[model samples]
Target: MTKRQSRWAKALALCLLASVASGCALPRSGPSKSEIYSGSVLEDGDAFVVSVNDRVTRATSVTPVLGFSSEFLNAGEVGSDTIRPGDTLGLTVWENVDDGLLSSAGQAATALEEVQVDGSGFIFVPYAGRIRAAGNTPERLRQIITEKLDAQTPDPQVIVTRLAGDGATVSVMGGIASQGVYPIERPTRRLSAMLAEAGGVTVTPEIAQITVMRGSHQSKVWFQDLFADPRLDIALRGGDRILVEEDTRSFSVLGATGSQNRIRFETQTLSAIEAIAQVGGLNSNLADPTGVFVFRNEPESIARAVLGRNDLVGDQRMVYVLDLTEPNGMFEARDFAIRDDDTLYVTQAPFVRWQKTLSAVTGSLTPFANYSQLAGN
Candidate 1:
């Protein structure tokens, strides 16, 4: 070979060796042993690592913090409105004899009159004086009045009806189309019926986010499930407030995925596989099939149960790795539930890093090699 050709060949050989060395030095595709067990260390905190099977088992075993059964939701049922303070009672008294205290000599029965229950829950009656009206139902108040007037009037009869009561209404607000206070006119007025009376939820109702707040306790049920399951269409109570709001539960995708953003759950429940699909799945060219990970902050109770470690670190955070290269991994992903605010990360494949390094070296040398070729010609 000529001197010029030999020199060119040596230069090419040096470039190839440098590229190979750089490629070899690139980080491996899979996580290191430390990273697999303890997770990639962050500036603020360390991520705890767990296997996919362990994560699935832990997730399946976890009891939901927020859930309501038909029976539990029905427990707040206000079957009938009981008289309460601020209620106006329509009372009528009758006696066989004309000249009774409630009725004049010319009339046998007294006309119905409105009597307001005071703040102390007592209503004034002509003969019965101040009577307790708050805790009693309308029927019970009628009986109480008849017994109290029995001594003064002969064969006295009494009728008690609630004209207006504050406790007889339920408020429907939030994402509903028509927000208002609906009256519970009947004994069997259910939650679903009240929501319907308020013109139903607004456009694109997030059924999974419906909440019923009664007194100090609150319960939640999916709007669609409330309609589909008759049992969940629980009877509503007086003073109950129903709120329909957008679904706030979300998970985030990061690293080598197609996109990195927080995705809200469209349904009541979302699985890990579905969450991945929401972010456009993993990047085929860059993602490492064996290095998919999910990071979560677990409740202390669940963390203790799953890890069996008394160490507080186990309770604070957990990292779950999924090997999508395996066929069963896809199945397991479908079954695994993803909770709110979880982080899903797909690491870059080792080969991808090596390829990028080699490509960079070759690209940098191309102009130099071209100049050498021209000079030789």
Candidate 2:
């Protein structure tokens, strides 16, 4: 070959080698490990965050409402206060009339295990056969027993007492120790006590996702409020079933984005622009300015009941395509909202993957070649 042609060929070879060895030529700074999808940017004026008292605006209309209610109370509304027929009572009643001494004679009178109250709320004893004990205080029962025994034994000593019934208990299932029934004493008013009884959530109970089911209705309480606010740690009731469920709702970002992987969106509303920022913004080179896609279920499903049918726009039900190439598009990207469980993927240029593979191969070859050359020397 001519000297000039040979020189050109050498230069080209060196450039090619450099491109493969360093990832600089791949367009994007680093090889992306994700696949991008298509989505849209919302109009700039449409996205905004509404404060609790902020006046409703076109932008604020899309924001979600945040508030507290009994259903949202962490401790949940006080369970039914009145005792029911099937309700189990963890009782501890004591009676020692006449200031009785602790002698062997009174030892037999001390009722121990399995001294259960029948369905009619009465327990029969040696002298006070079939005495009504349930619902009455230990003192009242003792007075009644004393009056009854007086007729037989001439001021006969009498005692009335009740202890926690082993059978009557509330079960704390899911995300807690002692996942079975816990004998309830007194009326349960605070939720934390029950949790403590059950060993306090298996692992924090995602406090925000906790649920309490009394009969049909279920209440949601955030753990933060339970401790931070006194109202959240409300008392519990008998037969109340508490469940510290996992927070199943979340979002994920993929492709040529700043942050990749899962991002939790616990609040009511999440927008596409917010999701992008959560993933650290798009990698400039790998991101296609013209073809950004937000993959989400039809907005009809997202805001169906949230916005109602009359409020939905024609584009609400369609997947939005956002062109982030222009400044206006940036504003629109900001407005395009994302929802829970939505996935945002920013795909690299199709050719980027091939370059990544080549770079890896070349990186491996250089190490092996250097090892061989040193050994040969």
Candidate 3:
């Protein structure tokens, strides 16, 4: 090669070497292990980078607790067939006398198919006057009418049939298959049955929440728990408002993993290992098994337990490290619980930085090599 060509190649190669040697400028998914730890409070950084262990696992393994209180669970169940105000009754009245009070001229019976019980709880009949039908079952209402008409019309018989009405109905809304008013019938008196009639929940059962609002009282329970634990299936009430919500709790996965996304909780609670698996595990080519990390804001109580000290107050920023290369690493990761909004990041292996540096060096030398080859010709 000519002197000028040789001098050009040497200058370019030196500049490339200098730039590659400065690994800090290399493209990476996130900060390296040392870089992340450099930001911790122990190193005058923003977070406490604690190594994963049995104590850390217990200190961080917290899942959301959701359920109904005693008042809600112990509330009495109303019979689905019970009568209530604003109900419409289908009544059939019969009389043995030739000239009946309610029957037409040649008819022994009269049909009152749509006898509505007024808001005041009374239904009106020609011979029976006004009688309280609310708070009484169809059979009880029939008996009440029979006694009232018996005094005027001899041997009077009465039949009352309950019909679908605004009374004793619940309004189901939110993330449900069918959103509307559902009657509290014999088949749907409790929360679970009513949810089924509403075409079930539209979201994942583990994260779906069922909320019931009755008058001044309200209660909530995990949708899956409703059937898992029968006690959560509280009775339905008239004018009750039920809401079914979608799975909203999620955690973000970043750094050297298969993909970076906010993953929704598949179950009520999840372990760090499970969460990592959900995001397609670590990036095999670049992930550093020795530098797995979890970033979260732990509550005061949890911070105290994790640090083994009571001096810390309020929520504290925590950065947890998981080294899968250790003997008990996998077990520790499996035991470490993942909470909502936690960040899972796997640092790129140190060799990855060196690889990036090598790649840069090779790329920068390609033109020099081509120039020298052409100059030799």
Candidate 4:
């Protein structure tokens, strides 16, 4: 080979090496500064901008009852008091007018003091059999039973009574202290009473969020509220259930942010920033402020439905994205909430992976001792 050709080859090799190294500076396949500031990913038409400093306003709009809007408004009531089908109905029958003879009287083993509406929407009674109790009030049910028993008993003195079933009894599920069914038969029995019956919440504080489902409506009940207010401390029903989810046992928090760990929280509601803080903030050397990503679980069906597909019904339907690059981002972290089973992912800066690749290449070129030294923390 000619000397000039050899020199050209060496020069070309140097140029190639330089280009490969500088390629790390290529525009990253990530959100840029402009995109971070503009929030272009959010749907424009129906989206609401929540600034870091925006005053947090909780939803106060109660679900409006269809076909009863006028009646509900004219009654000047903000919330409905009418019992719903899934709502608990506690019936207490006074045992005064039982048959005088032992043969006719209700036996302790046979007589049901309380009945629960099963999945079929029917309450199984001792002798009267399964009654459609979902929509009927205690008085209405008593009347129905009275009419049914007219042929057997004369004058059939029947007394229909209803006490609060909000806290009649419930079983503690998930991560609770003493997880079991408990009876709470009192007008003022608070949620603490039931939790106390079940021992208490699990030892871990990470999965401490308590959930209470009343029929079809599920709502998050704060640990404090179970004992805070008697009024808000809803009464338990026969079939009511209290689920005390464990703290985030295995979760990932990422971002231009805080802590990053596979941590658990006893409560379900964690703020976006709080989750980041839990994991350990962005690696100062490798974090891209504009490209922070939170890879949360999205309900496939809900997403499809919201995207205009009607076939997907009753699916969990939305994704939440938070950008912490804003000036007042800390407050947004405080107000931006999170749900259970969510994943917060903070993508590494482009230079980080490049550094890792370089380290690996160097390790391969070195002796075992040098490789170990490079890998040593």
Candidate 5:
């Protein structure tokens, strides 16, 4: 070959090499194709595999770690409603066919008189002066008053009834149609009953995110679960507060998915398979069937169980891959629970990367080839 032709050949080879290297070094939009499909490329403390059989067990085990307080699991049975400090008591005294201070001539009973329980939990009757009334059942208070007045009148009988007590009420706030304080009228009033009394949940509020605040402690449960499981419908206590709000739990879809966006769960629990369906499934034309990945920051306890170690970095951040090409992958996805704020990614196929690289090289070399042909002429 001539000197000019040899130099041109060398220049063309250098240009081609540079073009290929630059294409390979280009910044990726998301996780690399190899990282998604190859297990060897995954780093230590990077990813974990959840098989079909272990999916249910692993999901159920980690669910409590996602902010479910055990205190709300079992509902305590409510006992008889007791009197509070500000409760008014309707007192009635009776004497058997006798005209006394508490009764009239031939009258069986005296007129019902109202007595309010004082701040010190004491109420005064005509003969039974200043008796402890707060925290006692109405029947128990009646017996105490009757015993105290027995000697004053012949066969003296007493009856006590609660007249009004705003202090014995619970507050239902947040996303309810009618938010207010409701009086606990019955001994067996429960959470569901109180929600109904407050005009039910609002239209915009998420039914799956209901919270109950009792003093300093708070617990959360789905409205559907509260209704489905009678045990979760705990009995209401005085000063208890209920809050209904929008669901904040969500997951994001990125890369080669049908729609790349964040999706909120409609129910308390959602499986990985359901999440895929929610975002319109994978992009079949560009996605690799074996490259479905769920990126999450798993709890350290769970990471220890799955990875058999606790020394992982960055809060056990892991990428869990699912191979839809395998028959069992769909079944495993159905059982794998998707937690809040997780990321679901579907990576492109390996061939797609090569095709893109070759296309860039061909485009770059076309100009060089035209220059060489024109110079030769």
Candidate 6:
């Protein structure tokens, strides 16, 4: 062969190999499993290559665990009948005799409306003087007013009604169906009921998060968990603030999956099988079942459990490997839980690179073959 043709063939092979082996520059979705391990901090490269097994699945099945604390759940229940300062009271005082102390010249009864309780927890009635109304119930206040008016008028009767007030209320904010202050009534004495009273959340229930802030204390729970586990509903308190927002937890999919995108968790607990299904599963033509990987920076405590060693400190970079071709491979994947911020990746089959090389070699050979024919002529 002439030197010109020889040089052209050699130059073509070198260019093809360089482009095919381009780590991040290639058109491939991402690096293969072996390429990912080379990025480990350890020299041996095993620090990032943990195999998924029963022990690993159970240890790394860490999901977002959210709920109200004991203090929030164990709070004393407040009865809706109880009155408080800032609450408006409506009273109707009836007397047997005409021209009574509270009544007009001809009327036997007098109606006192919009009588709001003072900040000091006291309310004033014409004949009853000042009475403490904050801690007393409406029924109890009726008895007190009746006794006071009885001394001035014969057979005096009283009826008390509590109006919608700022006394015992909750301020709901964020993506709720309605954002405003809702009164804590008999129908909305609990967290779930109060949320329902606000017309439910604006976000999907699967991704909804309910946060309750009472004074300096605050607690949160997933909207789905609140209904699944009744204990998370918790009791509502006066002057409490509630917020219904979408969950912030998410995971990303890369490599040879059906789709590559950052996906928000739609379920309370997401398994590997389910996460894979969320992205439309693996690409049948390019995926390598044996190279499924999950990359995450796990807390030191979890890293210890996964590696069965305590030497690692702080958060450890972990890459768990899953082999779906094994006998119980699918079962292990089903049990493994995908956590927030974790990256699920599937490498292309090993032979896929060779196919590219073959294509490049055959495609380039045509140009070289034509040059050889020209040289012969």
- Note the Cα lDDT for every prediction shown: 0.74, 0.54, 0.88, 0.49, 0.73, 0.86
Candidate 1 local Cα displacement, residue 317, angstroms: 3.8
Give Cα distance to truth, residue 247, candidate 3, Å. 2.0
Assess the local accuracy of residue 190 in candidate 3 as a C-alpha lDDT between 0 and 100.
91
RMSD of each predicted structure: 5.6, 9.7, 2.8, 12.2, 5.3, 2.9
Give the per-residue lDDT digits (tens) of candidate 6, residues 84-181: 99899999998898778888889988999989999999999997899999999999999998888888889898999999967888899999888899
Top lDDT prediction, candidate number: 3
Candidate 5 lDDT tens digits, 1-377: 45687588668767776767555644345766564444432444335544334643374344422233556555464444588877777887888756786777788788566688888889878776889988898899988988888877777877788876654778888888899888877733788888888888874433346788888999887776776677778877778888888777789988787899989777666887889888888777778878787878777676666666667655665667777778788877887888888898888877777777667667676776777777777
The pairs that clash in candidate 1 are: 29-350, 207-223
Q: Between the candidate structures 2 and 5, which one is better when assessed by lDDT?
A: 5
Q: Where does the lowest 10-residue lDDT sum fall in candidate 4?
A: 59-68
Order of quality (TM-score): 3, 6, 5, 1, 2, 4
How do the residues 1-377 of candidate 3 rate in per-residue lDDT, one tens digit apiece? 88888898889888887877776557877888988989989888778889999988877878878888887788788886678898888999988988888888889999998888899888888867888888988898888889998899998988899988658899999999999998888888899899899998898776798888888887788898987898998877889999998768899999999999999898888999999999899999999999999999999999999998989988999999999999999999999999989999999999888888889888879977997998799
lDDT of 6 at 118: 95
lDDT of 2 by residue, 1-377 (tens): 45555565556557666765465555453323222211122333332111111121122235332223565354444323232333333322233443422224434233333466667777655555677766666567667766765654444554444454443456788777678787665544467777777777655433245677766766776655577677767666556778876555577776677877888764445556667776677787667655565545444434344333466654343334566676567766665666556666565765665667576656655655565556556
TM-score of 1: 0.71
Could you tell me the lDDT of residue 56 within candidate 4? Answer: 31
- By lDDT, rank the candidates, best first: 3, 6, 1, 5, 2, 4
Give the C-alpha miss distance for residue 173 in model 5, angstroms. 2.3
Summed over model 3, clashes come to: 2
Model 1, 120-173: lDDT tens per residue? 999888878889998899898998888888988887888888885765678988
